[model samples]
Target: MKARLPFIFIIITMMLNSIGIGLILPVMPSLITELTGGSISSAALWGGVLATTYAVMQFFMGPTLGNLSDRYGRRPILLISLVAMGLDYILLSLAGTIWWLFAGRVIAGITGATFSTASAYIADISAPEKRAANFGLIGAAFGVGFIIGPAIGGFLGEIGPRVPFMAAAVVALGNATLGYFVLPETLPQSKRRTFDWTRANPLGALMSIRKIPNLTGLVVVFLIFTISHQVYPSVWSYYTIERFDFTPKMIGASLGAFGFFMAIIQGGVIRMIIPKLGEMRTAMWGMGLNFVVFILVAFLGEVWMLFALMPLMTLGAIAGPALQGIMSKLVDDDAQGELQGIFASVTGIALILSPITMTSIFKYFTDSDAPYYLPGAPFLASSLLEISAMALLFVIAKRIWGTAATPAQ
Candidate 1:
């Protein structure tokens, strides 16, 4: 039990990180609408811009922070990020204009790159055989947070749009204080390396790929998969409002449901499934699930359909941890931070493209003058992207790892 304390702290920290995001999501549309004095459609465009700004910073800074953790150890970087994240929420809570919000997102983006360091912390602690299962635990933590955050945020949003932001700030700062006392140094001095700016750029991911030749195909799969996944956070709020006329409270409830089911699938179900199916087949099956859900979401007619779809919507979460475990094996132990950083960069790239593309599609399809009004257009696009990811993943997995390699054994 004593040995499990650090893992507890780490999982709690991850949950807090996600709670910070989820706590604000239900209110973001209204907040953006408030600040910009625009229609929901226009506010969505700005929302995309805000998300893109955040992603842009993460793209540039992810590798840098990952390397910094590699050199200086994970404790300082993780603590610093948590504190900074708290401050970003504080700044956002007080924002009076769109630019202030943008400034806050910039700060949030820079600090958010620490996600790589956190993933490395998990890598540092886990046995190779259990890594994928543990990554699912991380996903479960994220899901659990989402379950609480939106419910709280939706409730608080009735008080004021900014109320959730202030609440999120408190959660973040308090978590950082707790972490300062309990979080141990996972990366030892012997494993530390000098930080090189050259290796911390686009070259970093390329350099990693150069070292692990099989990673190139996986990276391609990762990119497309991430972009497809972004459709949710990018436009879900707006889509629901336009199509179903959902209130902030309803939106929160639905999102909470999504997270609840995701927590179950990732936290408990994956442990049973992955041991039976290797990472390769687990990922393929998960993606296949996601593809079906995307298509269902694209054609959904009523709010109940969404709630009905929640189980399948989340069952696909196995793909993320499966992919993470697969890639974790491709790198040396010392380079774990770098590997997660590379994927962060890949996620950043997806974030930068997905929001703008998705929101624009949302705007265009739902506008008064649209040739054909269809609020579900973005989900259609996502389904196409997901199917593409599935096809490529199968081809690449067969070519590289064969049918029976990397059994999570």
Candidate 2:
């Protein structure tokens, strides 16, 4: 229990960090639109801009940070991320221009790979068998933060967009100060890997994937699942506004429900469920269920429908840690940093692509009353992609892990 203290602290800090981000997310589009004197479409475009900008920066910096963490130890890296994040939030609160928002997001994205480093930190301390559960706990922290953060962000957004940003800034700053003392270094000098640019660069992670047997298959499965998953963030804000005629606060509240449902499934349920179900089987179940939910979301008209389907969305989140665990099991601890960095980059690629795809579709089809008429095509397409991803996962499992591998033991 004493040894687990650092993991607890690190996970808590992560929760706080995500909560800060989540709190601002729901209201951001509307706030930016108003601030920029742009159309709602323009607002939605900026939302993608902010996210893609962040993801692009993350795509570039994730491996670098992870590699550096391996050499310098996780404590300093973690602290630096927290401090930089807090400053990012502060800058967000002060932004009076659209460019300011863009700059803030760029900083936040570059520094936000704190989670990747956190993964490396968790790996540093835990045994192989325990890594899945610990990583699951990290996933749970994100779910909990998203659950609570949106509610706070929604409530505060009614006062002003800047108000929520200020609040997020304060929370981030406070977490950094507490984390300095509470979070200890997990990677000792004896275990540190030498940073190799060939293995740690943005292209290097993908290029290196082919050299490792079975890893390419796993990465392929991972990439497909992530691309479908990226759709929600890339388009949901615009979806809610156009479909339900929701205001910023209302959007925040709806997203809050989404986060709450995620917390229930991934945070509370995964711990109990994973030990019984096994990771691969559990992930397949999650993907199949997500496919069903997203298909329904495509056509559903009522705001109440989103509430009803939130649980389904939550169920889909189970794939993440399950896959993360699989990746951890397949690789050695020394390479966990590089492997997770590659994982971050693949997801970043999805983040990069999902926006341009979804928003273009939305803009082409969306009408003032389209939500009542046809809100299902994008979601339906997303569902098909999910189903395809599940098929790929199974094919990968059989081809790589062999027919002897079963999702559930």
Candidate 3:
């Protein structure tokens, strides 16, 4: 039990971090709408811009933060990010204009890159054999946080749109305080490397992934998969509101359900399935499941259908931990932070592009004078993207690892 304390603390930290972000999900579109004088179309556009700004900052800074953690320590970087995130939430809570909200998201993005550092921290502590299960802890934390966050945010949103932001700020600050006292440094000084700016750029970081043996193709597959997954975060709130007229509370409830399902699958089902199917097969199956689910989401006529389908969607959670487990074994201990940072940078790039694409499709199709109305267009696009990712994964697996490779234990 004593040996597990640090891992427990790390899980708590992840949960708090996700909760702070998730708390705003149910309220964010409404907040933007209220700020923009109640225009849903305008809110969708600005929401995309806000999300784009956040992703833009993360794209540039994620690798840098990862490198910094490699040089200094994960504890400091993680603490600093938590504190900064708290402050960013405060800024958002007090925002009087669209620019202020954008400013807040920019700050949040810069700090949020700590997620890569957090991943590196997990890599530091876990053996290669245990990495996938440990990595699923992060996903579990996300699931738990999302479960609670949107519910709380929806309830608090009834008081005021900005209330959830203030609550999130408090939660972030509280987590930072707890971490400062308890979170141990995972990367020791002996294993630390000096930070280099040249290698930390997004392009440079991506290039670094190519240098790793038997990893580049898989990294490409993950990037495509990440972009495809971004459709949910990019348009879920707007789509539900536009198509089903879901209230903030209803949106929160839906998100909570999604999170609950994800947590259960990532925390429980993954551990069971990965040991049997192996990481490569697990990833393929998960992506294939997601492809089918996204197509179903595009055609669903009733909101209850979403609830019924969400549990099935959670099966897709296996792909990430499975892929990460495979990559973690390919890199040396010292470069773990670098690899995680590169992954974060790839996700940042996807986030940057996805919000623009998903939100634009949503806005255009839902327009009053549009040729045809189809709010589900974004989900349809996501399905197509997932199919592409699945195909890429199949080719990479065949060409790189071959058919008889043993499962990642």
Candidate 4:
């Protein structure tokens, strides 16, 4: 129990950060509505703008923060980020104008870029063989937070739009206080390196990945898989509502189930599977399974089928931890934060592009006057993308490990 304390603290910190983000989601649109004098469409437009602002800031600042953590130590950076996020929520709660809200979101984005540092912190304490399971724990923490946060936020929003913001602020500050007292610095001064601004930006950070041996292809596969997975989030609610007439309650229930299943798989199943299957084989299995599931989901006619398929869908959660573990092994101790930051930036790029691509595909197919309407077109596209990623992964594996690489010894 004494030895496990640091890991527990890290997970709790991650959960608190995720919960703060989740708390805002259920209330943001309505909050925008009130601020914009009840123009729903305008509110939605501004909401998109606010979201873009956040993502853009994250993309730019992620590497910087990660590099800072490497130089200054993870404890100070993580604590500062938590405190800043809490203050950002407070600012949002008090905002009377749209610009103020934007400012709050910008601050949130900069502070919320701490995940890379958090990943590095986990890497600092974990052995190479154990890193995947530890990273999976982080995913589980996020899953639990997402499950609880929105439910509580939605309930709080009934009292007022700003209620959830204020509540989230309190939660964040409390978590920061806990962290300040309990969180220990993972990166020792001997392992620390001087911060370089040139390699701290997104492009330079990506270039740094290229300099690592045998990692270019793996990084490509990671980016492609990340982008393809965004299809679920971008079109799931719309697809279900259009196809099965699902209510908001049904959608919420489905999401909750997904999060719960993901948590269970990541927290428990992954640790068992990685040792037996090996990281490369496990990742291949996950990507292949996801390809099949995406295609099945695209064509399913019955609502019950969605629920039945969800368990199978959860198997694909193995890919992320496996891939991250492999990447962590390839990099040195000092560069873990930089690697994670670059990956975060890659995710940011995918977030920017996937929503536009997937939604446009959905819209084109679902339109009444389209050449031929197939609501599942976006899913089909996603399946093809996954196949591409799988094929690339296979090629890279063969190139690196020869024929013996399939089962990974």
The top-ranked prediction according to lDDT is 1
TM-scores of the models, in the order given: 0.82, 0.81, 0.83, 0.74
Cα-based lDDT for every prediction: 0.84, 0.79, 0.83, 0.79
Model 3: per-residue lDDT, tens digit, 270-381?
A: 8898889888778888888888898899878998898899988778868888878778877999999789767766777888999988888888887887678888888888
Model 2 alpha-carbon drift over 4 Å, by segment: 1-8, 71-73, 123-132, 181-196, 212-218, 267-288, 318-342, 367-376, 390-409
Identify the runs in model 1 with alpha carbons over 4 angstroms from their true place: 1-8, 69-76, 119-139, 180-195, 210-215, 271-288, 319-344, 394-409
Q: Which scores better on TM-score, 3 or 4?
A: 3
Comparing 1 and 4 on lDDT, the stronger one: 1
- Using TM-score, rank the candidates from best to worst: 3, 1, 2, 4
Cα lDDT tens digits for candidate 2, 347-391: 778888777666666655664545433544567677888888788
Task: Give one digit per residue, the lDDT tens place, for model 1 in 74-127.
Answer: 999999999999999999999999999999999998987766687788889899
lDDT of model 3 at position 79: 91
What's the residue-level lDDT of 403 in candidate 4?
Answer: 49
User: Model 2 clash tally?
Assistant: 3
By summed lDDT, the worst window of 10 consecutive residues in model 3 runs over 400-409
